[model samples]
Target: MSDKQLTELLSLINQRQDRLAFACKEIADWIDSQGDRPVAGKIRDSLKAVEADEVLVKKTLTSLTLERPLPRFR
Candidate 1:
């Protein structure tokens, strides 16, 4: 695919990741309200990796858009 298409796809993936993270947080909040602090904490901890991966995705997207052109994939 072209670089432009790849960038768009990555952008969409990043957006989905953000939404997933938001949903997870909402679920965690509900669980905490239900007095399951441990489960909620675990959920929050698990989100750490998702959050970190988000940063990496953002960086890669930036590089893909701004750096030299990449070879088109078949």
Candidate 2:
């Protein structure tokens, strides 16, 4: 694939990841706003964990976009 296409794909991937991260944070905030401390803490922790994954996704995406494309498995 051409560099432009790869760049565009990476941009879209980043955008989607950003949205997913934002949604997770929003959900976590909503959960925190509710009463039930224990339940909210647990759920918030899980959501935070998932939100943290966005960092790894961004790093990997950057590496993939900057480096040569990997060979596809047959």
**Maximum-lDDT candidate:** 1
lDDT of each residue in 4-66, candidate 2, tens digit only: 687789779779867876776677678677765676667667767667777787787676667
Assess the local accuracy of residue 31 in candidate 1 as a C-alpha lDDT between 0 and 100.
100
Assess every candidate by TM-score.
0.84, 0.53
> What are the lDDT figures for the candidates, one per model?
0.92, 0.73
lDDT by residue (7-57, candidate 1, tens digit) is 999899889889999999999999999999999999999999998787678
Pairs clashing in candidate 1?
Answer: none
CA lDDT for candidate 1: 0.92
Instruction: Evaluate candidate 1 by giving its C-alpha RMSD to the native, one decimal.
Output: 3.9
Clashes (N, CA, C under 3 Å) per candidate: 0, 0
